[model samples]
Target: MVTIDQANQDFAQKVQSMDGGETLMLCFQCGTCTASCPSGRLTAYKTRKLIRKAQLGLEDEVLSSPDLWMCTTCYSCMERCPRGVEIVDIITLLRNLAVEKGVMSAPHKKVGEMLVKFGATVPLNSEYEDKREALGLARKPANTLGDEKALADVKKILKATGFEDLVGGN
Candidate 1:
């Protein structure tokens, strides 16, 4: 059986190599982040538990959890952490690890696909375009889909980072 000490040592070594994961060692498991997370209240997403799993080197558990994807990157947990553990940043790191392991699945991939194809996840229907015009914003050219340039840039970065496969290709 894997001992807690062994787990901690493994996790320490793994996370230490990550750029933004240095502060993970300081987490005291106070559960403040879990308590403050809006998604945790509404769903089964437990930020504290996820952190604990990561700390224990339960990489498979952390990588396979759908709860990791539910974080909206709201930064509420980061603000509430008493230990000053970069909660949101750690979550982002876990997500990147999961993507690297090819453990992340679809729906997430579909969202990326939509962003690459339409420049936004949601289509800019006539109503939203009209609303933008009504709000006195100069209407973009009708041919303009969305932030095509930005999306293209994002695709290039994702490909370089090996996220293209995580998002189910370009």
Candidate 2:
């Protein structure tokens, strides 16, 4: 019962509109990206597989795959790509698409929530502050946590970018 109508024609076009997606179709499944991926070494992430899914325009599979967010955006794959494909950027675009579809994993959501609430993905703690002071560094380092204004601005930027809603931030 398979038919040509099953193809996701718009998926590639939609992804192409994003920054790194432009070179998506150039991938020939050389496995270079996967071979260069450090994350793929320790995790279930497979860069080549993701590129293949994207090339095939498997929108649902690409968007829902937890592997979409496994990319560290290191650009190692892009650098190693013989075809000069922007693999990291495409992965980032995939993450954005997944968020748009409200399919973020719990760890991603928690990190986003922490960023919105504390202006840092990893909130500063008194224990860490003590360690800093012990090391002759200021207990409160120069960052968003040290300045309420900076923290507010970070929240404002997140709101302006619509990332708050994307991460289900309250």
Candidate 3:
């Protein structure tokens, strides 16, 4: 349980003001999000815990905790929420907030780098390329790896949006 001090007042309100976060106040701690979270079943992540932290204004804990990044954004929680809270969107918004504030973790940073480089979070390897070639498909699949212009465009977009700075990769 996180304790909020006067210094952290209105943290919940701040989060609610964010896009896709407006319905955050609708959550009544029903625990449905937790019950429905696939990540929670496999990891230490508790969707309800994150929401509770946000609702209670535990800004520092909520932003800094790695659990904030555990959500796969599959939308199962949002689908099951009784209040129609956009749980997935809220989680994604929170993650964006966390990253913008330099609260990202190392693994996530690596994936961001891969996205910037390969235009996909999961990059390709020789094994997959060989398999694709064996199947008579374009070995590099016309994506960033196979297309120079597209890769340069991805790099350009990442740079223009400051995502490279945010995730610490070029």
TM-scores of the candidates in the order shown: 0.81, 0.87, 0.91
Tell me the lDDT of model 1 at 22.
81
Q: What is the per-residue lDDT of model 1 for residues 29-87, given as tens digits with 9 covering 90 to 100?
A: 88889889889889999998888878878777778889989898999989888888887
Candidate lDDT scores, in order, read 0.77, 0.85, 0.85
Put down candidate 3 lDDT per residue, 1-170, tens digits, no spaces. 54456236687788789889999989999999999998999999999888888888887788898899888888889889999999888888888888768788788889998888788888889999999999999889787878889989989999898888777776
Error of 2 at 134 (Å): 3.4
TM-score of 2: 0.87
> What is the TM-score ranking, best to worst?
3, 2, 1
Off by over 4 Å in 2: 1-5
Q: Report how far residue 152 has shifted in candidate 2, in Å.
A: 2.2
lDDT of 1 at 105: 57
